[model samples]
Target: MHRSDSRGVFDALVVGRGAIGATAALGLSRCGLRVAVVAPAQPAPSPLDGPGTWDSRVFAMSPASRALLERLRVWDALDAARVAPVYDMRVYPSGREGAPELHFGAYEACVEALAWIVEGSNLSAALGRALSFAGVEDIDARVEAVDCTAPDHAALTLAGGHVLRSRLVVGADGARSPLRTMLGIAATERDYPQQAVVANFETGLPHRDCAWQWFGEHGILALLPLPGERASMVWSAPQELAGELLGHTPEALAERVAQASWHVLGGLRVLTAAQSFPLRLIRVDRTIATRAVLVGDAAHVVHPLSGQGMNLGFGDVAALLDVVARREPFRDLGDALLLRRYERARREAVAAMRLTTDGLQRLFGDHTGLPLPGLLQPLVGARELGWRFVAGSSWLKRRLMAHAVS
Candidate 1:
């Protein structure tokens, strides 16, 4: 690894090496800026080949997210055999008999795919390669302190006692962002009484490039198609249910999943161990402070029911690039007004996604014992009504499909 020079100031310093952080470094560097990425070095991931070797965690990449990666010349580097395209999506309202089903298709939307299912590691590896090819400096160290009081620039002190200065610092450090804390930004956080269990499976029947989702009394179950006859599962269940599911043996768990999915894909053979993570909604009033900007999970996090968390992070990178690329020549990259423009452009989209996902989680959450307020009791039937509405209206479906692809 090459050590970053402490004497020279950078145009931007990215403080994370995840997909969003690495991509931000590459994008900013491409715009003729001296960029450096700060993070502890990590060992290379094992090759993702051979049968049953698949990542447990994957992301459903929207067309817009794909476009951003393509522009950065990173998408093509991904192993095509591991990527799966979603031609259609079928969503069934809570396991009620005779429940209306809502369907969205790439054909109806007049696009190649509704979205693509990609392994998180696959995306991260490609981004890493692109960053190296782009000549973005990699500071293999942890940030120990931040000083943004400097009028023209911010300084990041590494744990090794080296100080690196930059006009702007990007905090793509993630949900529990230390940089966000150091910058004195406050985030509103709410924890959902649920956890998402994820794993990959080899199905007895082909998924046919379709994504399946079911809302049940216990939780939400989604099966996303993977290459070949395999599929990835993300089951968002209440805390107690998640614990039970996680405790089951691999075979027992597969059987339980098969039963929950009503044997739609026939018998399921577990390809990977199940892992779970808590779900939550995180939002910050402002994404920028002085010479600092927060992107990705550092700025906001939403429920995974919509599978838009990663997409939203990628969207942040796109918006940040646009604002920085189009800024007035006289204004520096970290100019307060320039940063505000970036914030303004992202506010509405982020809020809408947060509201949509969080609202759906609350609406579909187990309400067996809990009583709905008299006036709000209508929601008990709203789920079915909303599904019927979306399913019956072609124009509405098309409108939604367009928004999703964008």
Candidate 2:
């Protein structure tokens, strides 16, 4: 529903063209909104030709995320040979002997796969192609200011002083969103004392489509399945340990990784150089204000331990599309009450995920080296008990798996 001419305003203007923002622009366009995406153009990634060239950054895409991409026609466009399905996941607790281990299987869940391990470059390439095919307008500029005071439409002033008007402005910027600041939104932030070190490897033994995770005193280490006899590792290690890891030679790092993972996939050889990113939790008081809305990391960022950060951002795009599509006929896309409806729909899910990821990080992160006295002993025991309880209960596992897939 576009307003009458002369003003040349778009129905929706999306800022940032990362996966989430790009996907939002496509979704908004499909919803029949005259949409445009504003961001500097990026060079397309070079083709992923071999094991040595695999991108170190990969995401564990949930079933919900898969379906959204499928619906948008971006799924089939991906390089199937590069995508890895996670049929099984084995989670091991701290190095205590006989520590309870949890397992999840696709068969138990009655699904094709628990999740799909996709390289960032692969997904981004597909999105870029889809955007081109869909012919969505692209505004290659950085936003300098936003004017949301207008009742009918919001105006975005670019870096060079050009202005673009849109009924609704969607923020898909990263965790440190400049648009969020321009909109005067406050975010509560907490930094984790660790960094996620990522790299890809060729396993000595076939991964058998299984993902492995170990929660040890050092940190959480996840080895997600990759095509062929390969795997991608996300090791959330303490800051000091991460620095040491980064300092090691590729061969030495591979040796360390093999030993830490108990050689579960046998020996490992480096396929990609190691890279590290700091971890943090970012939460906003609200996702909408006036004619504006936030999506992806701009709205929330959770610990990577659960591997649901990207999925949550996809969930935001899905919910926003649904709400705007079903709005009352007379209501504008940026109507205050209409935007609030989208916020209410996503509030609970976002909070629950933040609590779960943050809570687990705290629960397993203690390395105080102090003796637990009296009453504090049971609290220490709860970690083991919790894992055992979840592993032993089929119903609980199903519930947890069901939530994850959705």
Candidate 3:
């Protein structure tokens, strides 16, 4: 029987049915919590996989993320052929020729691969199906308001006039999380002065299952491997450079990209419509507020150049699940103390990621200057040094990978 507390209408009600929210609902349900998910509508039918159906939205899922998905049983559900293993990664220094590159390989990390490049569509389809199997109730409506102070203190009022109650509310919403706002949670944000232009391309040269990144003069370009000589591109460029990129026609874009990449992949041919989004670092001082907690982009977002955004969200889910799993039977899920455990657990990891990504973005960014005080090095000098240190230190990389590979 459900507890008689107002939040006991259900153990948790997750607002925002994006990938993060859906994943949260699935994980909590699997943990034996009475879970309900609120979404704008039932998920649209997943498209049938076909030739020339490559999705532009791709993620380089870290090994840790893979474990979470595997544990959730969503990893194997995705069509295996659609995924590409990132056996190697090469990162070049910005605007430098002959600089030693920082490289990561499966062998170095003692893992099968550094990460897996997965299509957003493929993962979504799998997670959607998994949510149902996990027995999470689906509420098909938009969340217009969330009340954390009422008889059902954590009640969510839907746009359609339906009210759903829960002992705890989780905001898996994106960067602009309405649920976060409803709980009066504040966050620190900094624009990277960059925008990401993403798309799919058929490369003249095979990627060899390698993910490559070039820190060029005006932007950071990453070509993540896809099957059969295809790769996905994420160019995090300055505002004007991003505008220039978006203005180019497909053929022009390919030509420009190939030139920018120094013909690393021989040549490039656009295979899909391009997409762009501004980049920013969002950090919440506290992820928990009253009876509600935030996860995924709702809690924090870092620069995508590191390709750790999705992985970080998965980390958030994993951490939250761990806290929930170890809670005392007598402790209510929404207990302030129970919620603080979740906050403390995540604070350090989240802070390190923010500092790393934000620091790197600023370093390689068009901005001039060293982030350190009284450092008399030119921008070029610092960038080279950073790359060299990463390239030189196996122990450092392995330690980093331990946290990264999950």
Candidate 4:
């Protein structure tokens, strides 16, 4: 990597080209500013070979995320046939046979839909086209160094010795962000004892555009609807259970999942390979520093059980864009005062999501053995009572139904 400064200064330089980073670049370009995306060279996308070949990675995008994508002109660009809308959600207490269920329906809440389940590939394709059409500069190179000491601009040294500078550097990179470390930002992380096993399955019964989740003793299980008679599964299982499941053949895994889901959608057939990833909660102390700011997983991470991790990241993108768009004419993009506005707007919401997911994990933690502990009984009873209260109240249901969708 030679150290020659080839690229000129830009209004903003975004690091990482994942969904959040791509969206950030697109959103900033709309401000009529020149933005450059610094990331590894992207391989050409291969054409789909057959019908219904879906990516294992999927996200249940909240309403807030959808609106932000729409603002960036990406929503309408996505393949509508492949997207699935969730009109209702059913959540059941774990480890209980006849526990009361908590339900949230968009119709009852007077909303169009609760959330949309989107395939990762569809999002990548949609965002990819938008980025090209938006005319954001793409510098395909590995980052050699990050220099933020400059008074006016933050600079990045590429492997080829090319230098890229910008008034503001946005880190929309995922967790383990090299940009976050390059900026000397530190994050606090806690490894959840659970690992998420995710896959797609073709269901015997139609999902009816509803999402189902069960809090079981082994872990939290969710079945998110997909287009047609298909559903995606996110089984946040204990480490031991995850290991066992990963060892099963596709047919065996299908049977296990069917039994666990109580055959609600009848027998299931695997549509994608089973994949597992460890769960964790991560929080960075500062989202913004001198001439630099962090967004998405680069800033915060939460347990996948709640399915709000990505939504929280999208919220960061929206907040930061709002701050930049509304900045006073005299203030630069990296103005400390302006970045603080974005950070402040995101703090409360991020903290709430972290606390909720962590609390739920602890509340339903494993207590199984030869004989159940006496204290565990009351805990279960209390959980049941709480469920009854929440399920019986229209206000609480509405309140929960609005979670992270704002």
Best-first order by lDDT? 2, 1, 4, 3
Residue-level lDDT tens digits of model 4 in 1-406: 5454656789999998989999999999998989988899778655543566877788989988999999888999998988999998898876577777888788876767888999888898999899999999887987767898888888888877888889999997789888888888889987877889999999999999999988867788899999899999999998999999899999999999999888989999999889999888798989998888999899998888768988988999899889998899999888889988998999999887776676656555433422223322444546666556656868756655667456
Task: Quote the positional error of residue 287 for candidate 1 in Å.
Answer: 0.4
Task: State candidate 2's TM-score.
Answer: 0.94
> Candidate 2 residues 1-406, lDDT tens each?
2223344989999999999999999999988889889987778777788646898889999999999999999999999999999999988885766977788888988889999999999999899899888889888989888988887999888877788899999999889999999999999998888899999999999999999988868889999999999999999998889999999999999999998898999999999999999999999988998799999999999999979999999999999999988999999898998898889989988987786677667666545433333323444657777567667878767766776787
Alpha carbon lDDT of each predicted model: 0.87, 0.87, 0.82, 0.84
Model 2 Cα RMSD, 1 decimal: 3.7
The predicted structure with the larger lDDT, 2 or 4, is 2
Candidate 1 — which residues are off by over 4 angstroms? 1-5, 366-382, 386-400
Clashes of 4: 6
Q: Residue by residue across 180-213, what tens digits does model 1's lDDT show?
A: 9888999989777789999899999999999998
Is 1 or 4 the stronger prediction by TM-score?
Answer: 1
The ten-residue window of minimal lDDT in model 4 covers 367-376
The 10-residue segment of model 2 with minimum total lDDT is 368-377
TM-score on alpha carbons, each prediction: 0.94, 0.94, 0.92, 0.93
Cα displacement (Å) at residue 255, model 3: 1.4
